[model samples]
Target: MNFQTSFPSLRKILVGIHDLGRKMAAGADLSHAFIMLDGSYGGKEIASSLVDEDPNSPKGMEQLKVRKPPRQISIIRHCVNTALLANSAELDLAMGPSRKASSLDGQSRFLPVFRSGSCSEIGPKTYMEDEHICIDNLTDHLGVGADFLSPGAFYGVFDGHGGKDAASFVCNNLLKFVIEDQHFPTSLEKALKSAFVMTDHAFADTRSLDRSSGTTALTALIFGRTMLIANAGDCRAVLGKRGKAIELSRDHKPNCNVEKLRIEELGGIVSDGYLNGQLSVARAIGDWHMKGPKGSTCPLSAEPELQKTTLTDEDEFLVMGCDGLWDVMSSQCAVTIVRRELMDHNDPERCSRELVREALKRNSCDNLTVIVVCFSSDPPPRIDVPKTRVRRSISLEGLHLLKGVLDSNG
Candidate 1:
């Protein structure tokens, strides 16, 4: 069925703030399933690629150093040498296979139990040009039968530049296109990549809208134990595995290595880190000014880079936010704060609120949005560091040498 016309034109009836506690419908009437995935069905978004990202997270990570040295206590026992290699957040946890739930026989015992919370604010900025959507239960949202093998939920953050129309349009329509894609539920990666381009194209074809306005899109779609993250532009997705920060999506900043190569390859010169000495992002949706012709092979692409991972017991929560929060805090810092908050209160809403507040306190220059999706209701357990042990022994020859040295001195 062509689901393109299923959703009527809903300009901005969505809730200003969204929170998902098991269900993402808090304070909003989204029973139509049109709020997050708003297009009728198989509706489109556009062209794509990585961006010159700067916020949510940097392509370059700032490693945390431990300033406090170990106290010089008298070593009564032999011990091995040890040093703190790096912070947990600085570590890049490897991504598991993008296989189906049935393929994860080992992780079969660990299914995702989602509870999400989100907050968006016009920090120091005058206008709120950011838009986002949170749906914890896609099965219910889609009105589909309960199938453990299908997609479970969806979340997205759209950061608009030039204007809010692009962000608003993408947020409302992107997911609908994904679910309505012919490859949906079976070939998720293909469906998502196709959906991103579709949404970008759809935005470009729309009439009565400013073609110049563009937005960076970051989306997280969870199916059973498999999570597929599609990102373009700079917004980021960081997964909290236990207490460690695991980056699920890369920031598509123009300064980023891969994005830079692509920009130069497409004849798009990035001057002062801006694409073609104009836009900051290398990729985006609805920037018809930069795109020119429909399939012109422009540098400002809208096609998203997809990252897939199988969720596990160690995976605790996922944080999706715009560059505002990231400009002030490191991914490690964000994860630490969220982990501590969850351990204390186990509330995703409070965590989201706290993250926004922290960013504002740090004097963020742009609009702020953050969504914290927890996999379990239980608070994260405290991470304990194991003590390092080593046994040191002296040989008989060493003892005799010491005695001979003492005798000579006497």
Candidate 2:
């Protein structure tokens, strides 16, 4: 068999292979070509063969498993199917296709899946005046009839001044009041506004509690993809949208131009950035001593300003923190730091803890409370910074001027 004579035989073999590939590409069945081996698929080492196929399990059924994922992953939560599986040690946790992917394909929109973490510290303060709350599963906590959207969450950071009574009270009862209002589950904005005013009035009525104490309230409530932020006083809510800082709530301080005008219109005085030369914030709750009556408008208002936005894939997380954190750190800095931390390890609790630690390092003078709520279990993707080429050139006049100056000095 000379090499030149064997060329036609090799061409025949290659042609035959090409025809087989085309047939496979046309969806040809090749089940007979497959071989079963222990290393081929994830399963227990059972003494079984291809001939011993169980009728209960159809072809490709073994690939669909109901697996309990690792504890680190909190994003993929719901079980849409009623399949039971065993031998967790042998199978991967991918259970099935991504519910989020399927849901997006069906709805043609983005929906938020919320998970939160929080940390509070009495840093550099003798007494802790900051109180915060985190509720990841509002329906389970408040019952199913609460009318909240599925996959929802609520977060708040309360900064108490004068005492801890107001902050603690709001942290405990604010949500309850909001949910129990007549307008709740229907008009959330109205319900939230009324709840703030009512909470203040109720505090005024409670003789045992310190009505003179006050707190700045900031809350972030999410239902499906929509997020509503309510704020009064200086505590802030900042949304981390793909490493950029999007301020959700404005800091209501005495020195703000709008607040100053409002205060002056209401006959309130601002002296040295303090309203009425005593309180630092323009609006707050539980400061009944400064207010006139239950429903009457006053300089020191309890009404909260609300802001709402729909969360999208670009929206990564939300940062709700008292002024302690913002006093020393910029919102963009915090967002950048938190995004980096999440990408390193998708743990919001650790992210919040580290954020508090950062504020402490910055010498923040007040009590600190920070809540970090991530929208997905997966970490944020890295931001690709566009590379720029900066061409540096000097003018001939500048060079001549430099030479003249050198000659003069000589």
Candidate 3:
């Protein structure tokens, strides 16, 4: 049963061992030799063993005589096999043989594997909330004497609650109100204030509220050299400037200092950290029920914090969203994702659609709305010069001649 007898000569032995080593290195399991040699070959198995057999020697030792040199070579070969195992392990680790090991830490890696090239809704969620409106237009006439306003003059995120009515009203009428208000100030500051107040008044009389119909208002009006933002509700306005998030609107929560004081001052208490223990609006357009009694100063007031800053070329875009979208995604995260989409497709609407889709995929339950206004468009068209209608001509020639004759007489 001596397997070694199969290859008899020294040259044959060397060739067989070398070939076996090659096969082993080529991924053959070589460790089976020890068990096969011991179990299958007995004392009388080999001719060499039978001739030199000592019946008087210790049981199995007399039958086995492995030379020291070959044994050492076998140990080295096993070590080479061990090294190969270690290298295989390292290769597996480096190459990430499994897909799970290659994923990123955050949501970026989990962006839905889009089925169709066109952006579409994943669930029941729509890219736009029913209550929100977005408008970006080039003004026909620039406001200033010499400098002209960019055609991109408007951007809005209307967040409606208790129903989409308030948001819908603002979206439909906000721009028109601003345009028609003779009282609207020439400066963005005045214009924003006028627009917000007028929008609130416009909302008050639009429809009757059965439940509690109210909305968080966040609007951005871009004019020459200025970016003006006004916000009243939980909806947010964020500017992505130089790749960072600059929050333009403050969250008017019941727990906030100013909001808490205003709610309490109006004979309302923050119950469980919510206004009257129900709503969280410190300032909102509607909620006539929460307005408290007449002659009360604490009614739901539509005061908005107006912010204005001179926009620079570094200002990439503005993100306006309802609290639904912001609840899951950080302002910077939204900005980063939207900016990436815009840079890839150069479309603001696509960016908006994706922003909402990502929010919904993140498990946001509320109505999600997002608007991205990119200020990259053709310059506004020129304004028409005012026409002058001359009714009467001044008698400048007679006056000049009379002055000349008087001087000559003198």
Best of the candidates, lDDT: 2
Cα lDDT tens digits, model 2, 1-410, are 78636664445434444544575678965332122221123222111322234313664335222222344542212211123123331233454357556766754466677789999999999999989989998888888576654566788889999998998889899998998899976788999999998888788888778989999999987788878899999988888887777899888999999999999999999999999998999999987789897888878988999999977888999999999988878777777778878989999999999999988987989999999999887899876545559543643333433443343335
TM-score of 3: 0.56
Model 1 alpha-carbon drift over 4 Å, by segment = 1-106, 144-151, 387-410
For model 3, how does the per-residue alpha-carbon lDDT over 222-259 read when each residue is reduced to its tens digit? 65546778888788888866456688888888888888
RMSD of 2: 17.6
RMSD (Å) of each candidate, 1 decimal: 31.8, 17.6, 27.4
| Residue 274 alpha-carbon offset, candidate 1, angstroms | 0.4
Q: Note the residue pairs that clash in candidate 3.
A: 138-151, 266-298
Give one digit per residue, the lDDT tens place, for model 1 in 287-315.
Answer: 88888777668788988999999889899
* Worst 10-residue lDDT window, candidate 1: 45-54
> What TM-score, computed on C-alpha atoms, does each candidate reach?
0.68, 0.69, 0.56
Q: What's the count of clashing pairs in each model shown?
A: 27, 0, 2
User: So what's the TM-score on candidate 1?
Assistant: 0.68
Residue 122 of candidate 2: its Cα lDDT?
96
Candidate 1's clash total is: 27
lDDT of each candidate versus the true structure: 0.75, 0.77, 0.60
